[model samples]
Target: MDNQTKQTVSQIPLLTTKAGPRDGDKWIERMKEEYTSLIKYVEINKKSDNDWFNIESNQMGTRWQGKCWYIYNFKKYEFDFEFDMPITYPETAPEIAIPELENKTEKMYRGGKICLTVHFKPLWARNVPHFGIAHALALGLAPWLAAEVPHLVENNMIKDK
Candidate 1:
């Protein structure tokens, strides 16, 4: 990771509890931690003029949807994204997707699930309960956008709006 990304990851607080939806009350506690960390991440992004996404979870806190954007060559490229927390969330990072980008790039899976770097899963494995949605966005999506958006634009896989 780059210095700026490291700094951004450091800014978002790590989640404390290791609870998933099946844990009942403990899951509630985990949710609180997730929201707090997300709020902090969003604020940091906003303050840095680097805000790139807006996300909200379902009532169960297991499904999330949002819009994410990349500004490349002074053009804004936006896409709607969503993901569902696996029953083993915190143990398994949710696979975030931009459905509209499906088949547009080789970096994505069949359903538009962004293919994380080979380094990502191992990193998440090491962090475990400490990593949350905020970390995923910072480490996963942000870098993917930085690397792929330029290629996508250059190749005409995506267009600026």
Candidate 2:
């Protein structure tokens, strides 16, 4: 019916793939409904061109240092990515690695590929909805990085204690 509806309909199939056999189809329908609501929220909250957030579009991805959830030097490590969702909303996780730290940590797995434990898991164990990517990145992955590898912040060493 509308562009937003079309996008939500399209995302249903992508979300379905992430579900298991018993609940996949039902989950897809539910996600499609939820995505429709999310689309409406985004549309209603669309910023004016003169708004500060909209005016700063050019600086969207640059590094900021006030309060980092997680910090790693992308220069030292390069990543290759693939995703099933649109570029604006990537559904799949990217792979990441650095040569020196390849074998020293559990976070990246032994093969040097970034794992997606937080990505696919439910947000709350109770009846609440999933927290999506931003929350997962902030709450789960960021804390995991800080706790599992404190040396990354202290000395940039994989094994420093």
Candidate 3:
């Protein structure tokens, strides 16, 4: 990631609670933290004119879907993205996908599940409860788009608008 990205991600607070959907009130506490972190992250991006995504979760905060974009050569390449939180949650990072790009790149698996960098699993494991959906977007999807979007555009795998 670039320095700007690192700085941006650092601005978002980390999750402190270790809770999953089955944890009841503890899960609610974790959701509060997740929303707090996500709100702050969105505010930061909007303030910088660098906002790249717009997402909304289910009432349970277990499923999310929205649009995300990358700008390359002044062209905006946008794609729809979605993910579901695993039962293991904070211990298991969510897998995000841009289904529109499913067959367009080798960097993704079937159904457009972006292949996170090798560092992601280890870092997420180490962070445990501290890494939430916001962090996953910052550290996983953001970088994947940064690295792949241009290639997709260049190869005509996707269009820019």
Candidate 4:
């Protein structure tokens, strides 16, 4: 194998062992490449450290707000909670959890594993192989955050109204 190909192969095990599914090797490589580019973009743009958002694991699957934002209860009809994203990227969907809510759980589906539709679906679809991790995360997370913020939605609507 060529040196580049050998290097790629060597990296696969490390990613797969942590995430799972050999199919994710390609996705992981793409993420690594994209992350490098994103880092460069941030640096070139001279982005402020505060501009970057932080999301912890444990709150991966569901939608939540800032460190102490609200979440959708769906049960008590309350959607006020804070959540974080999962650790695994591209390969596995994040696991969203509500630390304040008892018996609260965020999963992809009923008895399903954590899998972000925007992240994993496009990656697996044969017709769409051009999507990358950073792009997917940006698209999905942005909408999710907007949805969780009623004031933001209300402000936008009022401006339109």
Candidate 5:
């Protein structure tokens, strides 16, 4: 990458984790359940319908990094995001972020982790075992996009589709 094209990212605050012991076996069990439900929800909501959104997850270690699309005003916009799990597993919700939109908003961390400072995190904490990628997408990213994307489009910060 050329120096002229190099990106400059501003630091954004991350979610501070609550103190807890790390359990590998528990993490394994939670990940399995989460991924299963995530796939099922995506298949049912995205694949089975003619909706304005779709997602396909490709696992990479503890993260679910994949393609996601949203149709706005009859145009499709495709982007990539990752759901990176912290060591705390179910004790803390995975950091779901759109790397492509980095530095565009204060709502996201410099590393592209979306800041779930609102009800999203609290809700997930309340239903740790049940909350998964699907819940994060539905309750977190989807709503964030619905709100922020429009502002981004208006300012030409991002393309609307």
Candidate 6:
């Protein structure tokens, strides 16, 4: 067997004493990485008509909330999402919610939590080490909206707002 070098992780300054030493470091790194990815996602897709979306992120203690807007079929749909890094994040997955959209789809819980599909869940699990809220929104919610909302409108599933 070949010997591998150990990678050192720095302690996160923002973490409180309640946060365990090494685990907090990992969580902070993952959070920052995901947040950066989300920003890059918006920048890269800013000009693309079909895939264009805007995001505003706010750091709230350990959680970050993102306000996202996208245009589909010439109509604008806005969403407020909360991204939380649980102690088990990247291993179990992050907690995300869209509290404003209600009675929208079977995939959504009554409390505004999105129930990701089997397809995306596996993909997320495989890439959790690097995946973040941005990935969830871009790869998960974006496509879900593109495919589901049209049907919701056509079949009269969505309520008039």
TM-score on alpha carbons, each prediction: 0.97, 0.31, 0.95, 0.34, 0.73, 0.69
- In model 6, what lDDT does residue 109 have? 73
Name the candidate, 2 or 3, with the larger TM-score value. 3
Better of 2 and 5 by lDDT: 5
**Over the stretch 36-154, how does candidate 4's per-residue lDDT look in tens digits?**
54444334323333223333222222232433232322211122224333344434443333333322223233432223465435533431233333333333333343343354334
Q: lDDT tens string, model 6, 1-43?
A: 0121011001111211222113656545555565566655655
Q: What is the C-alpha lDDT profile of model 1 across 1-161, one tens digit per residue? A: 99999998998998889999899999999999999999999999999999999999999798999999999988999989999988998899989998998998888997999998586888999999999999999999889989899999899888887
User: CA shift at 43, candidate 1, in angstroms?
Assistant: 0.7
Off by over 4 Å in 2: 1-101, 110-129, 153-161
Q: What is the C-alpha RMSD of each candidate to the true structure, in Å?
A: 0.8, 13.0, 1.1, 12.6, 11.5, 9.3
Worst 10 residues of 5 by lDDT: 4-13
Model 3 agreement with the true structure over 12-121: per-residue lDDT tens digits: 89999999888989999999999999999899989998899999999988899999988999888888999988999989999999998898899888888999858687
lDDT of each: 0.92, 0.34, 0.90, 0.34, 0.62, 0.55
Candidate 3: count the clashes: 0
> Which has the greatest TM-score?
1
RMSD of 1: 0.8
Clashing pairs in 5: 72-161
- Predicted structure with the largest lDDT when compared to the true one: 1
Model 4 alpha-carbon drift over 4 Å, by segment: 1-28, 37-52, 55-127, 151-161
> Candidate 1 has what TM-score?
0.97
